[model samples]
Target: MMGKNRKQFYFGGSYVPLGLDKHVPMSEWEGGMCEMRRLGINAFRAFVSWNRIERIEGKCDFTELDYAMELAEKYVLHVVLNVGGMFNNIQGFRPPPWLSYACHCRHRIDDPLKAHIHEGADLMLCADDPVLQEKAYAFIEKAVLRYRGSPALEGWSIWNEPHGDPCYCECTLKAFRAWLQAKYGTLDALNERWGTVFPIDFPSWDDVCPSVDMSPYAHADPCMKLDFLNFLEDSFIEKFNRISALVRRFDPDHTTTFNLQGIHGHDMDRFQVTNPGISAYIEELAVNPRRVNLWLNMYLRSARTGRDGQDKIRILETDSGPRPTGKRPGCQKLASVRDWTFVAHGADMILSWIHRTRITGGHALQASMTRWDGSTPPRLETAGARGQTILRHQERLLGASPFSGRCGVLHDMKMYRYATVERWHGSFNFTTNSHDGAFMLMQDAGYAPEFMNDSMVLDGRFRRFPALILPFMPYMTRSLASALRDYVWNGGILIAEALFGVKDENMEQFWRKTPGCGLDEVFGFRCADMMYFDPVKDKILLGAGEIIPAEYFRECIEPSEGAAVLGRFPDGSPAVVSHCWGKGRTLFLAALATSRYDYENTALRTLIASFLENSGVLPLFKIRSEQNAGALGVYLATKDGKTADIAYLINYAEEPISFALFPDAGILPEKASFTDILTGKQYDDFAEITLEDRQCAVLFADRKDTAPV
Candidate 1:
């Protein structure tokens, strides 16, 4: 298990201490563990709160955690320890009162004008402050030393959904200055870039303080606040590094990962205040929305894959429903689907939000894997049984890692971050809707596209892909632009949307044409002009069929020497163009498509269908599904060695849905037969297989086209 090649798959839940105003009984821990063992759960997540273990200054007691670990060991379950995450009990992740009194650099929201102060609110400590970091180091060091040689300890996690209010205290202000100095190198460079004349090294950037406020940047200089946002991210990363490093000091072999919330979870559902009257600890339900969760898991895992190899990403927290409000009878069945989806999508562990529900507290009446009555619930019982069933096929999954796709779509995490901080433009707010839209369009067009990020692109993951797409990737860095250009030059077809690379790394104006980064040259078009307007007024007219309405924005683009006008506006301006570069090609659309209506139109669909001539072949498991109603709703792949290829059909509707499966176009596999791996029902027709509502089916077919590895 210690080897780099080792792969782990397990099901578990967070063990919340149920003690109301006193220490929880030993029977409670034992009962939870016993239930886990009975349910075939081999792992559990436990949180160590700074305030709980040590309510008084310099006083420490691991009694609660010790019993929890002992119970885990007795039950033969592995542990993923969340040293510090967001919620703790009914209250949030509040530091010991002793520490807060020592240094009052707790986090503050953007609206500093309100003079916000709450005694026991869910306040975040200043991540960049040295004194607070020292305390955190000490706290983690003690925990690490205590559990140094425990075989049950699998990994360490620091940020459990790490999104919160901005920290604008004195320490962060000074840290921001140092961060800017390191980034820009000197005061003169900072002054020249920001167009500000601050004295020298330690001069004040401003007295108003950096914040999530956009008015300052809109009214003043954009670069200043933008740097501040970067500084905040850097600060959070630094803090996580410090805490995780302390764990590594004692246990050198373990891997550390951070479980992050999706964009909306971080933005609107930020954990700034601990108001029991409003919502509980696990109130926000963003991660369970099927399409969003699948895409999120893929993108989040992309961040962890590297040259050394993929890290065993233990996503420690996410919503497992039967949420407090809705009458979701489908939730229990959904868990197994979600669990299998996470695994098939490359998640190694699924430690759900809770083990037992918290009762007689502020967070009482919250949903948990176990009911408030302490009886075994079907949600957990069934999900765990499915997990055990899945565990039997660990080798089938462990051997399968490579997910082949035709196109590589770029996901700019930094753009998402900036959008959450400063919403400069409503249309270009860096929401995941663009991702949802683009993914749906491609899926509907019979294509699977892997999400590529800065690191994935740099790592050459997209080198062999025939086509690449950039959807709503507004701000492009100089390095990124060069990298993408090189990809196109190297015989890779490139498909990019409007506003791709319009700005440099610092959000500065680009030197090249409107789309910038010499992309205009590559695509054989100079963006003469651009504007955002309602699609109802100005529409896109292709050669034939119905006129495709421009969704949100359009541009007055001019075709260069070798470029061909694929489509034009009703007024006869180039709305989309195609250019051949080297052994590859480029299709640059000058309009942003935010709706299925934009791409599903007859003219637009016909245009995309034509591009399939060189859009690279998909993997052997090509799916033609009737379940492509909302977003992409099917997962298709071949087993290791092509012994069998399977297409997973997920029906999220009220009734059953159907889809056909086949090998990719222009290929014939010898002696292929279909069987549902779960039901043992052989599919004779190879034409259409119907899956009931909220049901998932895995159809397997042996393929002789590819040899087994």
Candidate 2:
């Protein structure tokens, strides 16, 4: 099973044991595993500390692995065993001291500095080292050979998040030089791309050394830093390939996967630095199609800015009520919402940081379901309820392939890269970057969003998607823009938001007089200039004809095209407009608007919904309930070849909500009865139904006709 057919809903807990020195009793471990299974969790992610397993070189310990595998079998759960223990703030499973010596490396530096200061630890081993690679491959070979047949061991994760710059030691430096020499024929080509002086700083491939310090000068050079980033990623991939090959040699049936942090800018350095190699590796694996899952480490929150006005609090502490010291709260509520929304987008599995509340040490401040009192916290209840809903509908969800219609959102990594450049160069006057906002909005709209390099869109993969929403994609390669124009001319739906096709890849703006390439003819708008709005100071009027009220201003831009206005600016200019392109359509939103009142506005929501309805691509499902306020919680599931089996509605608010009954798109019974799966209450199909807050209702309805929609 590959592609969408293999969709799996994973509900796992981050099971990080406090101390690696001692193993938990079997009874205790079994009890915890049973409880997790009872809560409907089907997956468990844990690590085997290398330090504990292999205390000495050439020795193996299977005590913890055996226990974990036994518990997984007992609970009918799948395991995603992380190989290398935490390095980047994640706990590292310790490796035996002799293994590093056997591999010709040093000790592990994954432990706390205080604990390892006198031990002379080495965090990472050089990937190119033959001894290390052989030992590593052998270790994996043995490990997988032993556990490969275990039905509980679903897959193996090679390593934790490998950082941008790693192992500048002699071994890695030599490997990097070799890689560069292979990429560029001679030192001259390398120097030309790196923009380095010829005679003053030219060095032989063996003598070339990357700067140890990553300052603006060193990091800014796309060629140099990009190569370095590629080298690091390649090294990690090589190690993973070795381990994966070993696993597959023994257990080819079991799936292999890895966790990638999905937040913008942090894990990703520059576009060229991180994207090319990383995406290539991902594509290769994805075609082989490794399970792509998102690991949400930090909840989204309002981060505090530094003195220079850069966001300092990108990550914050969530408050678990008041602490015993009556100081330091836990994570904020907004962060939780944002985090959950990310999972809702495409994350097949939501792997939290820690499952149970820690009683001892390390990350005591981290939020978990079980609190200090050993009782389930409110967040636990929330997570459990949400998880249960997902579990009940897992089969349908996994079966329902991601939207396969020929429509994709054009996400250019170069635009994001250039935006980073502008941020560093201070060339633009924008507060909040619109790229994230656009991506999030498209995701919320239920579009299959993928990050594409500007060049990749021209490779004809994008032509498969009938529609492409390009939101603020600033830097467009000439080939990409031309491809888009050709796509539109060939009856493909194209939607371009503000500031698109304005600048080329070199950050040079296309003159207004320039014909065709300038989005003018495509969008029918010659964006003369754009303006930033303080959201609070402006209000958008929905022109009295729209379904939802337009209240606030997100961002405002001017439309030069005389397109049919779907919305207008607060000053009564065109805000949202649509124009025809050949047999296709192009939509342009001059300003960002909302259709839902919560965090998103209502107008934008209705607009998108309406667009889907008009496009004849909206899913066919009817949410019939008496719930009024928490209407947003209603979800409908339909199997492609079978009759829709379940209709789920959840009320996340504090009070009861009622909703009017609506007929199932075309499969509704005249007077059908529905069995509430949660409460087991049988109710005749009425005009409406009501549900209490934090409560979910799963209705099993039999169609009177038993015909598919």
TM-score of each: 0.85, 0.67
| lDDT at 471, model 2 | 56
Q: Write down the lDDT that model 1 would get.
A: 0.59
User: Best TM-score goes to which candidate?
Assistant: 1
Q: Could you give candidate 2's per-residue lDDT for residues 664-706 as a string of tens digits?
A: 3454434456676557776666356776644556666655456
lDDT of 1 by residue, 583-663 (tens): 678887788753433323546645654775645434434456545443225655544433335555565444566766664
Backbone clashes in model 1, listed as residue pairs? none
Full-model lDDT for every candidate: 0.59, 0.49
Residue 242, model 2: lDDT of: 57
